[model samples]
Target: MSGHSKWKNIMHKKEKSDAQRAKIFTKIGREIAVAVKEGGPDPASNSKLADLIAKAKSNNVPNENIERVIKKAAGGQEKSDYEGIIYEGYGPSGVAVIVETLTDNRNRTAGDLRHYFDKFGGNLGQNGCVSWMFQEKGVIVIEKAADVDEDKLMEDALEAGAVDVNSDDEVFEIFTEPNDLHNVRVALEAKKYNIISAEDERIPSNYVHLDNEDDIKHMNLLLEALEDDDDVQHVWHNWENEGEEN
Candidate 1:
């Protein structure tokens, strides 16, 4: 937990260009569509949908866009049938990698991912090849500010059913059971904590360090390629890239 500062990754994402941010919104919209189709348009009754709505808001997705996507999805206006897929592999220096994607065409997604990995000095592997090295958890991140009380926040999070809290100069990271994410987030919001992000994430059991400059370069390229893919939603890796700029 100490090595995995999720805030670093969050800040990196926040610094992306406008076009990349739009791509992020589109990917999240697809997720919202799927959630609506599975449960319903009403976030009140659908916990998954509720969580996704919170996630969308944290990413600065506008309320109108969220409502429009929900309405369209509920009306069956979205015709694309997307399925969730998880791909596990290893990057340079045996760094474990897991990619979560939602794609209408599995063949195209697989081919693109494999090609990227190969070109970047990595290899896509069979399912569970690297997934076993990670654990799924609900992570809630809050931006640390001058007015925020660290002790009070920790107490509030624990009272709200959070398992643990980790902090750095920039943020407070609260960990919870995967199913308890929504409830904990709601509790924190009720307490008036400004949540930066709340979503389920796969935390690596251990991290891999790249000593060679080539390994580091290739690892970064591989991660960027996976993240830039239209079908890829979340990319998790075991690289201990705490100080390095991504």
Candidate 2:
């Protein structure tokens, strides 16, 4: 119910809508910049940067842009290198929310996020707000590995401490609790499985389905604004797309 799956599900639909497409690239790029600056610009040596790069590639961001960002960080020209922050809150219907942001100015980022939540039928909470309702995890999505055997992949993932696995039409997704992500990723790599993207995400323990269509329309407005922020990298909520069987 939480973590990567929820985000992925939303993004999958949004990608085709052309909504937030530009903002998506901006946020992902900022993530790439921060990861490189903090970890020394060597993806091989910096797992964080490597993961961000993988995500950028999936979204079709140009390699030149990524390379330029890495070089800028390496050269120290960028001011106030960004860092990721998790803001906990709640949405309508008591739905838990977690917003992950990468910002160069914590004060500005905090204020922007808080203002949005307050304006959109939700209120930002203290640090522990709603976070207790989630579990941190790593989600890996492999696009259409048709030749690969599911059981074998699951077995390898389990040996690496993977918690669960699921597949839909053209994607194979693997989940590993936060602590096991690195180990599980390494295991998968050793097997030469093609991985499309991987990242740290929050997953909710329970979901609050908006029974009213109007609630979804409004909830989406809030989610959209949160995502449009340049500093916001990911938004997780206990929302189920109507009629989506999870």
Clashing pairs in 1: none
Residue-by-residue lDDT tens digits, candidate 1, 1-246:
752356676676567524577888899999999999999999999999999999888778999999999999999999999999999888887889999999999999999999999998889999989998888999998878888899999999999999999988788899999999999999999988889889999998888878888888888788778878999999988787733633
lDDT, residue 244, candidate 1: 61
216: Cα error in model 2, Å: 1.7
Q: Rate the local accuracy (lDDT) of all candidates.
A: 0.87, 0.75
User: TM-score for all predictions?
Assistant: 0.95, 0.85
Cα distance off (Å), candidate 2, residue 213: 3.5
Error of 1 at 109 (Å): 0.7
The TM-score measured for candidate 2 stands at 0.85
Worst 10 residues of 2 by lDDT: 237-246
- Residue 133 CA displacement from its true place in model 1, Å: 1.2
lDDT tens digits, residues 1-246, model 2? 443456466455456425656666677777777777778899899877777777787777788988988898788877766677889887766778889887779999889988887776788888887888877789887655667988888898788888898877667778988766766776787789888767777777887877766567667777778867778778877776622321
What CA RMSD would you report for each candidate?
A: 1.7, 3.2
Candidate 1 structure lDDT: 0.87
